[model samples]
Target: MSHECTTEDCRNHTSTYLCGRCTSDLQQWLDKVPVLVRELSVTVARLDNVRPAGGGGGGGHQPGSAAPISLDALQLQENLRSVGTDAKAYAQDSRAAGLAWLIQDWVTKAELLVSGPDEPPINHAANRERVRNIAPAMPTRELLPWLRQNARIVVTSMDIRNWARRGKLNPVGREPQPTYHPHEVINAWHDTRVP
Candidate 1:
């Protein structure tokens, strides 16, 4: 007897419950399960290697010291725990069991923990003043090319303009094309590119 395949998106008829095409796709998906599991194990090992930002092992203080945990490290630990929980939940789910999203989230959190904000976050005004005092301002046109050549990173003129508009990048001069401090631009590049 011929009947429609049980698999979604499959319209072929089969004597058995699943059509040949659907069975082939299911076999391919099953074959990927081992690879995904191995990748997840590697990710767990990498996360285990993630230590506190400072020279400390667990927290930001010396080993066996009584110093309180830094807020940044604490947040990192929390994020890691959340990732672990999410991974377990994904494993338990029968459908949509891909690990790519979980791995990406873990990587993003790890990056944040490694390159988090400066201690006692600086205010916008103080940051602007510090940038001005450190280096001379350069117009966007000149700065873009210089950054690409020196920093070996491609930061386009439009990126600088958009960052300035969004208040992510600060400018020194307001007339014509806005000028940005060299150090500020470098810092921005490091923040975004370093990982």
Candidate 2:
């Protein structure tokens, strides 16, 4: 009796237990396993490098104390193990589900490692540049006239002050009168006026 291919997603009938097409697909996935494992190993090594030099005992070593492992690192390690196990299972059974799940989990772990908060701390300079790019900074005194001329809307000083109090407008400098980014003020004005 003819048997169907054992690999998931394969529908070919085969005289043998497994068809050649399914066998090739399984081999391709198995080949990728080692590369993924190597990538995960590199991420773990990078995490190790960033770890604190010693257990936080304030320069004194405590007995039975070791450096604390990051929770992210531990999770990545667990994912690596799961991938390895599933890859083996996929190899034996030629089941696409196991390898697909392993790939998805590996991708998640890699993204966490690459994008963890510690690296490339917030860029204040870039933020300033972005604000400048959005609109030229204008003093509150100049802002009211500019808005009336450019935005075709009349805004009172009290309205600007209220926007500042409400956190809709962020002032750049000293109080009593502060500079503002025109784009932000314009957006806030539009938002408030929306019925």
Candidate 3:
């Protein structure tokens, strides 16, 4: 969906609430902004607001004194501060939107894990043991490639354990933290050993 305005006139329409035409134009303007520009706009606004306004005007009322900052300058400074705050907020909002997309992707993957048919049945420990006995000897360099090709469908820890129990693949004997070849894990889903 898009709104209607074609020119900068919509910028002013911010306060009035853009009519359908200008709303579309303004949206197009926003869409074209690079993400870096959006982030930088916030940072620049923040820096300008905190800097001092007075400089270069010296005076001694009786012996020595400096003039107070002008009210107009102070007002202008406040306006700049407000703009910076708005930029920071926009940057945060944009980041949140990006994160939302990433989370959605993660959720979809998790859903597939729970709902897909390729997921192994959880109750068959004996079948898992049968698959495990066929696992090949480890410490061999060929293990990684074999597992990748044969066990490509093995998706969970239980799948690996089942393959190992059946003796089709052997996990490396690392003390306290053994790891197995990726392909050996994959071969388990075929209801056979890796050889």
Return the lDDT, model 2, position 161.
Answer: 92
- Could you give candidate 1's per-residue lDDT for residues 10-60 as a string of tens digits? 678766555666555444444444444434443433444444444355435
> How big is the positional error of residue 55 in model 3, measured in Å on the Cα after superposition?
71
Residue lDDT tens for model 2, 76-193:
5566555543333453454554555455556555556655545667554464456457667788889889777766678888988999999998888766658888777766777897
What ranges in model 2 sit over 4 Å off? Answer: 15-18, 48-64, 70-133, 136-195
The number of clashing residue pairs in each candidate reads: 0, 0, 36
The alpha-carbon lDDT assigned to residue 26 of candidate 2 equals 48
Superior candidate under TM-score, 1 versus 3? 1
lDDT of 3 by residue, 1-195 (tens): 333322333433222233444434333433323432333344333433233234443342223433333333344333333322122233234242333333334333333322334756654455445546776455434455555555444255555566667787577776554577543454455446333
Looking at candidate 1, the ten consecutive residues that score lowest on lDDT are 88-97
User: How close is each model in CA RMSD to the real structure?
Assistant: 14.1, 12.0, 18.8
Clashing pairs in 2: none
Predicted structure with the largest TM-score when compared to the true one: 2
lDDT of 2 at 172: 84
Return the TM-score for each candidate structure: 0.31, 0.34, 0.20
